[model samples]
Target: MPTIHSGPVCRLFVLLARDAPLGVVFRQGPRQLTQLFLWHTNTDTFEPGDRFVGNLSPERGDLSPDGKLLIYVAANYTMGHHNKGLPPRWTALSKPPYLTPLALWPNDEPYYLGGLFAARGSIEINLAPYALEDWREHKPSFPAGAPPEGLVFEYENLPWTPSNQLFTRLMRSGWSQVPTRQQSETVDIAFVKAHPTKPLSLVLGMGSGNSHTYTVHHEAGNAKTKLVGAVWADWDQRGRLVYSLDGKLFTAELDFPGKLQPSEIADFTTTARRRPPTPESASQW
Candidate 1:
């Protein structure tokens, strides 16, 4: 068995822009929490930037392909130790317990990002929307009464392209409890990394305890077999994917409509011995 390090083990979450050399990393200390840092490919060091004082995990947000926009889930409540206020009566019968408000942050800005509302749940950005305008105008909601037509309730599980053109969802295969109906469950997709250049291809990370990666082709209506087991993953440039498994790093090629394979790039278990911890290492892919 691998001996767990007892010292402060810093956890890092990196988000790299598809078209730009810039990236942002959220570092959580085993003993303390600090601000996020900026990473540039041209520089070997990471510089401190904005401080995130929220309790929400950093994995909840992602950078756009162009590296200009950031879409992330922001909490409706305030941060810190305080009693959670009473829930509205409508929450019991109709409304969701928490509202999912997505904030779109720009790289150029130091503080503000556009705030947009969506259904409360795990959400991700669909890199290829049918039309940019459709994505811009999309307002998702779940009411007690009749919901709007063509609304995507599973936007979190599947990637959205313009016109809902290419997407995937989890469906059940067993019989349903209801008479003459089959029961189905949505595949709890934990993370989605769309191809930066390909509109119809992307990778889906699923599973709760044991992670699995799958290559999806929206237009073909089929996906390849599990490519590998990964706790989390992110896209690099056009055809590369970086993922973490068993506390080690690996890279794979995105051969959509073809076989996908992964190769080990770095092992955190041993790398600690070679170099001291630094801000750049916290954001290293």
Candidate 2:
């Protein structure tokens, strides 16, 4: 039998595009290493992107509506390997599935800084008051006072604290806070995010020192309810149920509420570390 090391459990976070049949997945395993994958919801296939020796913040990431650009917050504390002399923590913009940064901004404060797509080609980044640091391939307009045309920056110029920023991203994107009973401790909080069109909604709980965990609860019209062992889940662009469980991703048709016949999409627990080369066409970002 093959040896199974009792190492840390691998975790996955899925980011689906708003208007496209595309998704980006972050597979974190073993330790600080994280691998990125591009998911094609059109055919339920995944393509390997690249890996980073640092840690990526899923709460601080946002995929563009067209699935072309990716804005993520990454941190590398290693001193010798490839710190690049940039800040210890930074927010970066890169092509999906690849860690090769196209435009970078330095951040003094690492946690809770996030970015989102204002439109198809425009983005708003929160860098903790730091300015633009580098632009590798193509340079976008940088303005300190006001954003460029066709761009609506609501959270870029504002300061982001720990809880406010995280909650704002959820509310701003699609999620709404689910009401809970008033308690004295006030530790448990929940949110329900529904698909824009479908009748599916995912209930997620946070707080009580377990906000990073992605345990989900499924309640179908107040009839059938159960704790579906999903690490992270959401609806894909095609209105199909896409969820991650046991270090693997699954996609299933909404044949019936509260019952899912999941089809495996990708497994991250046994995924090998790879550094796929970025194609030349990826540089145009």
Cα RMSD (angstroms) for every candidate in the order listed: 14.4, 5.6
lDDT of 1 by residue, 117-148 (tens): 23333223432233233554333323323333
Candidate 2 lDDT over 157-189, as tens digits, reads 555665666676677657787665521134377
Model 2: residue 261 alpha-carbon error in angstroms: 3.0
Inter-residue clash pairs, candidate 2: none
TM-score of each: 0.37, 0.78
Q: Model 1: clashing residue pairs?
A: 129-162, 130-161, 130-162
CA-RMSD of model 2:
5.6
**TM-score: model 2 vs. ground truth:** 0.78
Residue 64 accuracy (lDDT) in model 1? 43
Instruction: Name the lDDT of candidate 1.
Output: 0.38
The lDDT leader among the candidates is 2
Q: Where is the poorest 10-residue window by lDDT in model 1? A: 88-97
Whole-model lDDT values for every prediction? 0.38, 0.66
